[model samples]
Target: MKARTESDSVSAVAALADSSRRGVYEYILEADGPVSRDDVAGALGMVRGTAAFHLDRLAREELLTVSYRRLTGRSGPGSGRPTKLYAPAVREVSVSLPQRHYDLAAELLAAAVENSHRTGTPVEESLRRVAAEAGNSIGKDADSLEQALEKYGFKPETEEDGSIVLQNCPFHRLSQRHTATICGLNLDLLSAVTGKTGPEGCTAVLDPAPGRCCVRILPPDRD
Candidate 1:
């Protein structure tokens, strides 16, 4: 499955904001299997057309998946048209203000722990390696450092000294509890991003400050 983007999450949330659409989605979620529009309409006390409208809307927003199957156990010619059915989508939808990425942090830390157990490398070293690998992957598709940082919710702001200060940390809560570890991972990740896709002679370094990300981007002479 493709990875869900922030816009996709926002669209899903908006789609469910309608009472009828939310009710239709909830009914499908509670079903044992995919349900037809008629089933939803009957269960929710809505008209068939209204239920169908909401179901299609939910499917369009990716909050529900659609399938077509004949309800009756009959063969091709004699059977009626395959009924459209709705089911809960496998993708999870989440939206956070200021745009946190705790899921990404959790994934990195879990991979680091597994790597440490398998190779006898220190957990911190494994974490840095994995985080750098992830950053490199992300950077390869990015056109510039600032674009990459902004895309990941770092909120980069350029300074007069030709440095970038990140105004927001994507892994804020995790860093608060495990400052050194999380900050180190953040620094390594941004460093890799800078190395792989540069704004020319820029470097990522740890420069922790209150109410901001721990990593900063600095020009060659300032680094």
Candidate 2:
């Protein structure tokens, strides 16, 4: 998961505000390591003051952490005072969406993928583990496989054909790098929790509206 947007953070869920804060969120998210405010501005092509302002808000909200450090002094000329760095405090953020009957499995799996890459792991390995972990909790006695999906936030309902439509995404608008990983995680979670192993190559689609993402589950069984 990536840092929450500004609107997201201020909204109900973990989200923040609009894209302005989201840009800073993304900057912290993409850095291979902790970064400075100046670097964030440079990375996002925004002014240093603007970046710092957002960074301060995120820190105030406990979204990110700011710390000052002292570095070795350079004998040359421009050896200034200690520098400051910013790092994402929380790894993931929550977004709200309407519940739909259709379950799109890919989006969830993509989340797992995003998380895996963020932590420097292969996508498949992370997904497999997530699948196994979630699947281990299910027993075959309750509602349909679709019903079981609800426990893991899948919210799936069978469509005209074998398609399972997506109704919600607990994680939305994360960084691009983390996007696919977390989507993958969601997929693995759905597959494991339900023991359906939804079709491969599932993709989560955001419709032409705000806070609307359509997830299409691939065939449960396919080559």
Candidate 3:
């Protein structure tokens, strides 16, 4: 499956916002396997047409996957046309108001722990290394530091001094509880991102302030 963007997630959540569509989706989810429109309509007390409409809408939004199968065992000649079945899509849809990325943090921390155990390196060192590597991957495709930061929900704001302040932290909750470790990881990640994508000699540094991310990006000429 292709990677789902934030827009895809938003669309999927919106598709489920309708009470009828959500009911149809829930019914299909509880089914033992892919379900036909008739099955959904019977189970949910909905008309077949209503069920079909919801199913097709969900499928169009990529919330549900579609397949075709003949419910009855029969030869190709006389068997009726294959029934369209709906199943939950493999993709996960998540939408946070401020746009948290705990999954990304989990992935980075899990990899760091595994690497630490394997190579006997300190967990902190492993975390920094993995975070930087992840940042490098994110930065590679970005045209500029602000673009990359914005893409990942950092909410970068440029100051008149040519510095960038992150207006929002994507890992806000995690950082609140585990300030030191998460902030260090954030710094390493953004520093590497700056190295790859920021202006010449620009750097990311930890400069914690209320209501903003701990990391700030400074232009090369800044003192």
The best candidate by TM-score is 1
TM-score to native of every candidate shown: 0.96, 0.35, 0.95
Give me candidate 2's TM-score against the actual structure: 0.35
**What is candidate 2's local distance difference test score?**
0.58
Which one wins by TM-score: 1 or 3?
1
User: Comparing candidate 2 with candidate 3, which one achieves the higher TM-score?
Assistant: 3
Candidate 3 lDDT score at position 205: 91
Q: Report the Cα lDDT for residue 88, model 2.
A: 81
lDDT of 1 at 67: 88
CA lDDT of every candidate? 0.90, 0.58, 0.92
Rank the candidate models, highest lDDT first. 3, 1, 2
Task: Write model 2 residue lDDT over 1-223, tens digit each, in one string.
Answer: 4433435433523335567788778778788888888888888888999888888878777778788754555544567776787888854444444333122335436655886989877777867675556554442433555655564454566667666665555445441247555555555445554454333443323222244333455454432
Clashes per candidate (backbone, < 3 Å) = 0, 42, 0
Judged by whole-model lDDT over C-alpha atoms, candidate 1 comes out at 0.90
Q: Rank the candidates by TM-score, best first.
A: 1, 3, 2
lDDT of 3 by residue, 181-221 (tens): 99999999999999999888898999999999999999998
Clashes of 1: 0
* Over 4 Å off, model 2: 1-15, 71-79, 95-223
